[model samples]
Target: MNFAEKYLSIRKHTEQLCGPLQTEDYVVQPVADVSPPKWHLGHTTWFFETFILKPFSSNYQIYNEDYNFVFNSYYETVGNRVIRTDRGNLSRPSVSDIYQYRSYVDEAMVKFLSNEIKDDVNELLVLGFNHEQQHQELLLTDIKYILGNNPLFPVYSEFKSEILNLPSAAQKLLNIQAGVYEIGFNGDGFCFDNELNRHKVYLNDFAISSSLVSNHDFIEFIADGGYSNFNFWHAEGWDWVKSNHIKAPMYWHKIDGKWFNYTLQGLKPVNDEHSVTHISYYEAYAYASWKGMRLPTEFEWEIAAKHFNWGERWEWTESAYLPYPGFSKAPGAIGEYNGKFMVNQKVLRGASIATPEAHSRITYRNFFHPHLRWQYTGIRLAK
Candidate 1:
């Protein structure tokens, strides 16, 4: 994809997510987990302007020099930024005003990409695009969480998940003979800061489940006192269970007679065919242990993903999210993307239904604290 097309397409996807949102919905910032919609719009623009535009364009000028402080998300070396927690306080640049800022950025970015930018700018531009795509997903998830928390249980958009009957009878697990396999991105395309410095990784003989663990499978576990059974949980998992009193994954609310999961499109009857998301690594580990299975290491997941379209749902892996071998922090602010979270986080493979297709890829590694279930997280079994 050329510069304008790819950039504009990503911009459209971000805008589309906001299209269904109300003005009131844009400003609800509930803790660090959920960023205001206006923040996402401004922050993504900051990524491009700071990384690609200013460095590459000799004559580039920031739309608002003050915005560099307001929206510079964690780029320590780049300069001071607005304190993260106070993001909700910047109410002056209203959601509508932020949209105008995005448009202003679009004009400048298009002009830069169309002519004056050097060919070397292409790679960084792709990185900026992928970075924006990541924020787009975050925008949806954060918005959904914020809206769902409203007493009335407002939905940002329709949760239109179609339960498809995969040709179950025809589907069979494909055995990829174990060997040393190269994991991580080596392709000449856009990938995140995490999937870099590609190299070889060894794997043992292992079998991946034909599909992700389903909602039905999870329900059975819950029905069998999965949450109450201490034997099935790790010490940490048990502690988490008791501390939070988590009966089930977040969003799986038990109504009068049955369970319903809140989704982006809205609340829907839990579909058994869909991968059971919102599962934590703690719960996923317990479920795997109960079934005599394990979560695949990042290496195993990447090897298997070589043969699939990376699936519609991201599969949780046993791998703790970490930087690749010989990984070095990127100079300046861009370094914050992946280097910081190299510990105490697990890797997730594949992508979710809400994830943009352009952003999905095999080597993509998503990481979060083991306790976070708000993202579209699920499990794939290994043995």
Candidate 2:
């Protein structure tokens, strides 16, 4: 597909992901971490207008002046906007309005891309699509969080996530030799600025698990008082567990001594064969400690990923999200995109099933607070 086709395909898929949502479903935010589905539609459209159309397209009209305040996320260089937590309270820009906003931007974007454009303009356009794809994954997760937390336990759709089926062959750890390994995105294809300035890092010999930790394995940890014992948890992690009274993974329920979890399809028995997901970094770390192992560093993960199959879940790593050795940010609002969030966040590698195609690479860096588990997060052990 040409650039225009690729752009159209991404936009259409975003709408399709929202196809199952009812009018009311699009408005509710179950948790602060998950924005309302409607907000995603508007926010993604806002990105294009704010970054691409307004600057690049000649005489390109802004969709809605007020949208800048309503949809801008953490871009301080841009104008002020709604606080992240209050996103759910918004109702004036109704679902209908949000879709219209998307249409308005789509019409302008399609026209802009149809004509010859400069490389710089095309670069931002590609960044916009990639940005939208990131939100595409968030849309599903936020929708899941919304529906899963509801008392009604409504199903988002009848579609069930495909379960990963790793062979029963002996799960041996792939041993990576200690040496200097080049890391980060070095390709000519489009990549985020954070991935640039690839450099070499010396790594000690380490072994990574062949497959992700299964639900059965986590259940075993739970059964052995993994939660009750604070030894397995970090200082803040134990505090979080105790404060929230978290006894099991999010969405898990034990009734009649049978374990079940909420899925996109609805409440169902926890599949022991499937890799455990919806786990926070704290849980991943504690689980690793419980097994006398540790989560791999991002460097270890990127270097060793070639030997094993991933992409089943966003695997948590021990590395904190920080700028690379020689990393530098571009000027203006784009600079604020990633460089600012380098503090107090853990890095995750690989991609989840919900992640858009071609959106993830070996160098892709996913980060969140250690306590946030609304995404499809899982664990991989290392030593």
Candidate 3:
């Protein structure tokens, strides 16, 4: 597909994901990390308007002068934006207003793409496509969180569930010989700046699990007092567990001595065959430690990724989210994309069931605070 075709398809899918939601669901933000669904709709539209049409399209008209303040997210280079925590408080924009804004901006984007596009403009266009795709994944997870936490235990959609039916494979370790290996995005296709400077790293011989940890395995961890034992956790992780009173993964509930978790389909019995998800990096690490294993480093995960089936959950890695060698930020607001969030975060390899098609690549580096488990995160053991 051409750029315009790809652009429209991606844009349409974003709206389709929101089709299952009630109007009230659009404005709910249960946590600071997850943006309101309406905010995501407006923010993604603002991206195209702010970056492409404003600078490149001479005939383009500004949608709303006030929208810059409403939708701008973390782009200090652009201007001030609604504070993160206050996004849910933005009930004035209204879901109707945001959808209209999307329609308005999307029309301009379609027109702009019809003209002769320069190489630089094309680059930003691709970024706009991906930026929305990132939020598309977030939309699903955020909607799940919003509904899962409700008193009614609302179901987002009966058709959407993370649990997948696949033939059970025997769990074993895939051995990697100790040697120097190359990592990072080596393709000519578009990749975030963080995946640049494809470079070499030396590794000790290690073996990584061929399959993700299942719900049954995590239940065993809990039965063996994994959460209760401080010896199995890092100092910070143990504190996180105690302060938050975390036992199982997010959306998990123990009732009548049985495990149940909230999925998009509403509350259901925990499937032992499905991979255990909604796991924090700390939980993943503690579980590995309890099993006398470890989570693979980002580089190790990337090197060994081909040997396993992923795309089930965002697998947490034992790697700090640091810049690769010779990595530099792009000029202006775009530069702020991934460079600013490198600290106090852990890297997660692979993609989740919520991830969009064509969005997950082997070299993609997804990072989040260690305590977060709202996303479809899971564990993979290495030693």
Candidate 4:
């Protein structure tokens, strides 16, 4: 797909991913865990509108003047946003009106992009498309967190995922020989700044799980006292786990001696073979330790992942998330994308089934606070 087709297709697919939601669902922010659906909708648009549209289109007009205040997200370069906790409280553009606003912006963007947008901006445009795609994923995950809070436990969308099993269990560990390998996206095409300036790294011989740690494996971790036992956790991870009293992964509830999980299709029996997701770093680390394993370092993961399918599934690595060697942030508003996240985070590799096929790649650096699990974060074990 060329620039415009790729842009519209991805943008439209993002909208379709939202599925059916009642008016109230659009504004939900039950805990600090999630951004409201409306916020994501407007934020993605705000990206293209603010970065590409406003900068290039002389006649471009913002749909909502207050949006930059309400939906600026974390772009300090652009400006601070209204109090993040109160995003749901800004009821000015009722949910329906937000759709109208999106339509208006879409119309304006189509005209501006079709007529005057140049080939030189293709990279920036692709970056904007990917930025929106990331938010599109967050839109699903955030709403999943939000919907899970309701007593009704509503599904974010009606579509149920059909679990795909690997050809074999991939139960056995595969040992990767020590070698020097190039890790990070090659800039063969459009990629986030975080995955740039491809570099080389040396890896010792190591074994990584062929598949992600399954729910059944995690249950075994719990049965082995992985969470309750303090020895398996790090100092801060122990404190985090204790403070949260996290008995299991998020969306998992123990009832009448059975474990259940909330999904986009609603609460259902836990599928043990499906990769255990929505797990915090502490939990993942603890589980790894319990299995006589250590989390793969960032270099190890990126190096190893480059050998696998790019976007199939995101793998959790042992790396303490940080910037790569000789890494330099791209100048301008877009540079804010990955540089800000270099501190105090854990690295995750691989994409989820929920991830858009186009947006994921091996070098994509996904980081999160060690305790946050609302994203489609999952772990693969190694020793």
Q: TM-scores of the models, in the given order?
A: 0.93, 0.98, 0.99, 0.94
Query: TM-score: which candidate is best?
Result: 3
lDDT of 3: 0.93
Compose the digit string of candidate 2's lDDT tens values, residues 192-258.
8878779899999999998899999999999999999999999999999999999899899997999
Name the regions of candidate 1 deviating beyond 4 angstroms: 159-174, 306-309
* lDDT score, candidate 2, position 343: 94
Once fitted onto the true fold, the runs of candidate 2 whose alpha carbons sit more than 4 angstroms away are 162-169
Mind giving the per-residue lDDT tens digits that candidate 3 earns over 1-383?
88778889999999999999999999999899888899989999999999999999998889889999999999999998889999999988889988899999888888888889999999999999999999999989999999998979988888886855556678999999999999999978999999999999999999999999999999999999999999999999999999999989999999899999999999999999889999999999999999999999999999999888888899999999999999999989999999999899999999999999999999999999999999999999999
Candidate 1: lDDT over CA atoms?
0.80
True-vs-predicted CA distance for residue 223, candidate 2, Å = 0.4
Worst 10 residues of 1 by lDDT: 162-171
Give stretches of model 3 more than 4 Å off: 164-167
Candidate 1 per-residue lDDT over residues 1-383, each given as its tens digit: 77798899999889888888888788888877778888999899888888877777668777778888888888778889778888887776788778888898888888877875565677678778888888888897888788777767766655445233344532245577878888778877777767888898878788777677879999999998999999988899899999999998778888887999777656778887677888899999999988877888888888886544445566778888878888888775667778987899888888886686667877888887887877888888888
Q: Report lDDT (Cα) of residue 285, candidate 3.
A: 94
* lDDT to native, each model: 0.80, 0.91, 0.93, 0.77
Q: At residue 111, give the lDDT of candidate 1.
A: 85
Give the clash count for each candidate: 3, 0, 0, 8
